[model samples]
Target chain A: MAPPSEEPTDGAVSPADYRTLCDLLRERTGLSFTEAKRYYVQRRLAERVEATRMPSVRDYLNLLRFQASGAEMQLLVNLMTVNETYFFREKYQLDCLVNGMLDEVVRHRRPGERVRLWSAGCATGEEPYSIAITLLERWPRVDEFQIELYASDIDSMALDRAREGVYGERSLQALPAELVERYFRPVAPGSWRIIDELRESVDFSLVNIVDPAQVRRFTGIDVVFCRNLLIYFDDLGRRNAAAMFHEALSPGGFVALGHSESMSRMSSLFVPRRFPDAILYQKPAEGAGA
Target chain B: MGLVKAGSKGTLGTAPTGAAAPEDWTALLEHADAGHRRHAAQALGDRPDAAATLAARLPREPDPAVREALLTALVRIGSPEAAAGLAPMLASEDAGLRNGALESLQQMPVDAVEPQMDALAGSDDSDLRIFAVLLAARLGPAERSARLHQALERDPHVNVGLTAAEAVAELGDPAALPALEAFAARFPDDPCVAYTVDAARRRFRGAS
Candidate 1:
């Protein structure tokens, strides 16, 4: 544990300090601060202040400025960003991703057609890699197709971990034994790292799901695995993101949402497709109108 | 020292004997440095006394690595005392600690945690609530089954509702069949809910 960089001369935290922290965070990560977030900011920053052995909040802010060049920034981002995930998380949705969606995309390919999958808000990279592994397992000639997986998260640190593709034993619990043996290598004492093949399959980048124009740039995606991530956003944000997915996807492309999330209330742009325990949506094919 | 040595794999005082009495386990703990603590703790291997000692030292350990070692030890030890030591850490300020503690508690035998299952079921924390549902499913008590049915109806978290539905299926209680049916009807597309409903129907039919 690092000591506080600087001790507060006054016991009270000032409003200016709070504002500065919020502004900095928003500028860097685009995470909006709610009225209730003041306490969360103070608590998280207090932990950092202690960890860095900084003398004061001002000094700590300065340290953050320099953190991009060091490990401190990475640690801070990792602590602040929420990586709520599990093995085979939202299993029903994954079933849809693996079952017919990939096959449909592959079948529709015109000579040099490429099947692309994007996992927006892919914390720690599990969702995208999970998709890749599923394709590799189910589709015999999957590698022959020009298959590309794009995984993105707003948090750079999370992207870093996703790129590294290492996970502990606990994360592997829900994964099947065969999948684990085939896709991962035992890296640390009790940790399993994703194989170089799987790691190379995914292209990790820092992307804010809320940005529409940026999303529109990645056109012709076959399937988008954006599961369990939209719950954090408000209704408007969710709708905008849904619309973005609607536009980014190729005709008849599929969208897999979190188990609890539905576009029923937000957008009728997608027609809901029912699987055994999962609900997904597909863009209407040619001659079909929403 | 004798207690620790008893728990450890290696023979005690093989090279040289010292003033360290077998009763002083602190020397054993001290010799068990950070890197080797996990292996040393594993040496305890399900002994109640060793688990209790490790539990006592876990809360105050400043090093996250050491705390993780102690947690792994407790999980392997798998005693009621180990569960008790880990319960409070479920609310640890550190996410890593909380994740570790919850995972350890999840691995404990459902029977050992049966007494506290109800409280966990009613917890505001979504993590604990889901864990309770899984535990109830494992234990299969009538009262827990009913509570889980109610949780399925009212739990805010969908995962909790899904887990509760699964627990009711495990209980195989006919009374829960209607609720499971309703849940399936409402979230007909949710595979987990469908699985639970199917399992409950099969179990209910078999029972009849």
Candidate 2:
């Protein structure tokens, strides 16, 4: 066998090396880079270096370039991505969902029209589960309604965990005692899992929010919860995502964003509406606000 | 007291009569096994304080699920004390705990939560910082508005900056209008910037 590839000596790994790594990551994963991310990359790759038994950073970089498989690529993506979320996160927005948006949807939905919701960037599944639980709580005969909940995240690991629907004591804390006891089952020491009833209500998939074509496939959705996540992107990314959400929603459907997110700068495609405590956007009643 | 005794029947332990017997309603919350905690928790709606007490006792419970239950109760209760109880957990080392605390705090009224708002605004964690900015927007007193201005100037996260800018605009402090205009100028291409600017302009026009 040929001699092993040369690895960069300790002192030789410089800012230039890091820049190359950043470029490669951006090229492959579409993650934007700012000065702040340098440290995160260094720290994450440092751990990977030790785990791979690579003698140096240069060798690791080469392996990543030439030998990385789909799984390895996914691992790299997951490591770099952050999935920070909680149940009923941004309650004001959920309030809009249960008290305002859902009520309106139920009222206008033609008899037998299946109401569907998509929670984009759902992060370990809290948003969608929250939606399902809210419906269950609000509608005494929820089974009589045709409701489909679709939850998607870019991270497969998060999707897998979300599918499990098992949360720790902390994840359940904000939940009302009744919902918790009713919806979850204790699995291990200090681990409570969402029951099949709630879990079954959601369909989890791995999806990138930046992918417009894939997003367009989801049409006629009654409501979309894409909260807090749009802040991560650059202007182009945000605009793309916003336009996609606009297209995905049925006319008169609502989109709830993170408190900080707004559509005013991106497009006139949505008409903003203010509820008691939250802001929502509606694809103006057919032929109206556009 | 009599209600407590009557409520305690069929519970794990017999309630001592006339001694403020454990609320029988409390027994309605006990699951046969930890496996049923979610169901029991859900059944205890409108009684979050009592449910919180029970949730705090489940040592063998899964930490995330139990925390979720406890947090649910706290938010539903919407009591000042419940909000206070969750304040410190915002700094928890466990991400889940910190997140749960932040979520619960978000549900509270801004006036009732002004005291703890500063700590969150000053947090190193981005989630806490963002939540604090939003919460601060709901608070009164010129000081809260001033603090939001400072946060807009100093926060490292762009999103935090945007939230602070929006909050300042909401306060309708004419003093904030120029700054909001300048901030909006920076993100000329940001869709959110237009909303922020429009809010500030509306406030400025209303004040005039």
Kindly give the stretch of ten consecutive residues in candidate 2 chain B with the minimal lDDT sum. Answer: B1-10
The parts of candidate 2 lying over 4 Å away from their true place are A1-14, A17-30, A52-69, A139-144, B1-208
Kindly list the per-residue Cα lDDT of model 1 for residues A158-234, writing each as its tens digit. Answer: 88889898999777888999999888899878799998877876777766665533553567777888876777564
Per-residue lDDT tens digits for candidate 2, residues B1-208, read 1001111122112212332223543553454453245434433434646634543533334433334445655554556656666776766676656665665566555655777776777788876787787777666767676667767666667688788777776666777776676666666788887777787788778987
Alpha carbon lDDT at A140, candidate 2 = 45
Which segments of candidate 1 are over 4 A away from where they belong? A1-39, A48-78, A140-144, B1-208
Local accuracy of candidate 2 as per-residue lDDT tens digits, A1-290: 22334334553445666877776664454465666777777777887778788877777777888884656556676787788776777877766676667767778555444677889888888888888877777644355556777888778898999988988877776888888789888899888899886787677777676554356457677788888777766544554466567656777888888877887754445788888868888877665735
Docking quality tier of candidate 2? Answer: incorrect
Give the lDDT of residue A10 in candidate 2. Answer: 53
> Candidate 2 A-chain TM?
0.85
Report fnat, model 2. Answer: 0.00
Candidate models: Cα lDDT each: 0.68, 0.66
Candidate that scores best on TM-score: 2
